[model samples]
Target: MKHKRLFSEIKADLTKVEKELDKLLAVDDPILSKTCVYLLQAGGKRMRPGFTLLSGRFFNYDFKKILPVAMAIELIHMATLVHDDVVDASLTRRGRPTLAAGWGNTVSVATGDFLFAKALEMIGKIDDPGVAKILADVSVEMCQGEIQQIWSAFDVKQNFKQYYYRIRRKTALLIGLSCRLGAMVSDGSLRHMWLLETYGHCLGIAFQIIDDILDIIADPDEMGKPVGGDIRQGIMTLPMIYALQSSGHRERLGQLLALKNKKEAQVQEVIHMIKNSDGIERSRTVVDKYINKALKHLEELPKIPAKKALRELAVFVGERSY
Candidate 1:
């Protein structure tokens, strides 16, 4: 099935989440309100919220209780993106000027801080201390992961173990939390929650891998930013790691990557070298491995439409180009 059609089951719930986001983001200050709304309107897959809603369906799918958690997860995700743009010095996202680009870093930082505070406020309404702690811990770990990335930048010798550690904290934890929170809020069985969380965690890893691959290979127009953004920033990704480990062009690739200030041509050259190597294909194989693991977890869940949807979602994560 096509990606859009896969989410048809939760379309209405996602729409409600969208409306709630607008209501929650509204503020007295016009600038903050507009910037927040702009970020919301920039559009994302809402995959985290979708996972929450779908995971809830396996139990008592209480939209009233589930919506706040979904919104909070999405808000946290958006806030991270805003801060990431500032950290990465990104100019655009989804083909539009990023908050940092349009409003400057000071305003962007404040905007990200505002979103984080608001997300905590929203999730706090849920009367679950465990849930609150989980979110808080995940948030802290994500920040730590970013710092780790900063410290490890341009280090071609970084290993697979370090890469997995960084991505689990950076991308997988919150997505896994999304599924767990959905099951928890709706009072699903412990088995169900664990299964869903594992599925999300595996899928999240694959999702980030694909994103890294796209940064190297996707069309600039489709990607909404320049390709090789990761390489340019000296953030070694899975594909780059593989190329450095096994590619015939490792020497030249490492030399170009090690440059403190790479010209545009040098960055493109690295991209070209990696593409022509086994890195892209090897990275794709790993994505498949995670997707299979995600699907395996789904097999134990109750046989329902949501299970099928989750299966499709996992496949999409492995295959998405942007």
Candidate 2:
């Protein structure tokens, strides 16, 4: 069997899809349009859009139709990031100054809202009420997830279950929804839709788990942002939670949390402690579970090139070091 990375095999299609994303996001107003385009230009893995296209392959395989949905999905994602900067008080994304950093909170928030409105408008043109509803509902869940994260921030007393729920809503919901919507757009069977939806959900959870892991393990240059960012913000992730709960470092973690200084040296120590402790291993195991669950969904899909590509994507998520 010939093996090719999904994106590499579909390079031409992906390129056109990216161009459509650029076109849809173009705006006339200098400030709002520029800020909106800035974040898109900053670059992302474009995984959401990738999933959108891959899932669509199961049905109509129309890049023209799929591109708008992909752009809308990305816009929804970028909007959340802009708002997230304000909520996290973050200054940088992908190592560049964030909208909140240069434009101030009000402008950033309004820009996010504008992008969201644009996404909704695009969805309205899709002509599939079911697709429209799914996208709209997932947007709600995404917002709710953000609100939940804020509510749970710095609350070390929270458990793994609460942490899982937060990530699922905030991160996984859209990914799963993207797959589901894509499958719907392609006119895929209900069984395929269910499988793809589940696959996207598991992959999304794994993605977020990797994100948390990289916070401690990845180099700042590679990550395009500082490590220990979540720690500096006092938000505890799975690895941190596992380290605190499973290891005997609970007291130490508590002490670090109580500190007001939070110097770079101290934050590095906390990161080192989390890394060297059982936290990274435990977090890796958690990711493995999601990866396995994702693979199980793939088993039901017909054996084909796209299915093989998706399987590799899942393993790539769990096994990727950076």
Candidate 3:
């Protein structure tokens, strides 16, 4: 099934969330307003909000309560992207110029901070301290993950455990929280909440792995960023890690990665080497494993349309190319 179709059940709720995001992001300053609007217009899969709304459907299905959470989750995600572009020095995203590209790092950082503060404001309306704490803790962990990535940049010696640790915080935790929050606000049983959170965590891992794979193989136009952007920035992803560990060209790959300022030819050479290695295949295998695990968690949940949607979402995550 096409990815957009997977969220059909929650389409209306997501629409409401999108509208709320527009209102929430409105600011008086013309520059900040334009930047916020541009960020919103850039568009994304809205997966975090989709996960929240889908998980909620299994319980009370209260849109009134769930909408704020969904909007806040998306806002947090947008904030991260804005800040990430600054950190990565990325010029484009989703086939458009990034906030940093247009307004420079200072404005981008401030915009990110503004979005984060707005997210917190939205979360505050929930009246659940547990909810606030969960989001806060995850936000802190995400920052830590970014720091760890920065420290480990161009360091080929990093191990599997470190990679998992960074990704869990960087990507998995928020997704897990999205599922957990949906269940919690909708009065789901503890067991159901656990199941959904675990499902989301596994799917999140698979999602990031596929993203890492796409960074090498996806068409730049489709991917909305340059191919090999991760490697160019000295950030090591699963494919590169796998190649360094087992590929015959590890020595040459390592030397190229170690370079602080790589030419386009060198970046393309590294991409060529990784594509020929087992790294891409190995990463796909890992993604399949996590997708399987995510599916297993859904099996124990009650049979419902939401359950089926979540299952399909897991499959989509494993196979998505862009």
**Residue 299's lDDT in candidate 1:** 93
Ten-residue region with minimum lDDT total, candidate 1: 1-10
Candidate 3 per-residue lDDT over residues 1-322, each given as its tens digit:
2767999988888888888999888889988899999988877889999999999999999999998898888888889989989998999898998899999999999999999999999988987888888888889999999999899998888888899988898899899889999999999999999999999999999988888899999999878888888888888899999999887889999999878789999999999999999999999999989999999999988889989999989987887843
lDDT of 3: 0.90
> Whole-model Cα lDDT per candidate?
0.90, 0.82, 0.90
Which ten-residue region of model 3 has the weakest summed lDDT? 313-322
- On residues 91-187, what C-alpha lDDT tens digit does candidate 2 reach at each position? 8888898889989999998988988898887887787787788888888888888888787766777688888888998899899878887788888
The residue-by-residue lDDT of candidate 1 on 1-322, one tens digit each, is 3766887888899889999999889898978989988998898888899999999999989999999899889989999999999998989898999999999999999999999999999878877888888888999999999999999999988899999999999999999989999999999998989999999999989989999999999999978888888998999899999999888889999988877779999998999999999999999999999999999999988888988999988977877843
lDDT of 3 at 108: 96
Clashes within 3 Å, all models in order: 0, 0, 0
Candidate 3 regions exceeding 4 Å error are none
Cα displacement (Å) at residue 257, model 1: 0.9
Off by over 4 Å in 1: none
The TM-scores, one per candidate, come to 0.97, 0.93, 0.98
Name the TM-score of candidate 2: 0.93
- Give residue 186's lDDT in candidate 1 (0 to 100): 91
Q: Pairing residues by index, what is the TM-score of model 1? A: 0.97
lDDT of 2 at 111: 89
Per-model root-mean-square deviation over C-alphas: 1.3, 2.5, 1.2
Instruction: Give me the runs in candidate 2 sitting further than 4 Å from their true place.
Output: 1-5, 258-261
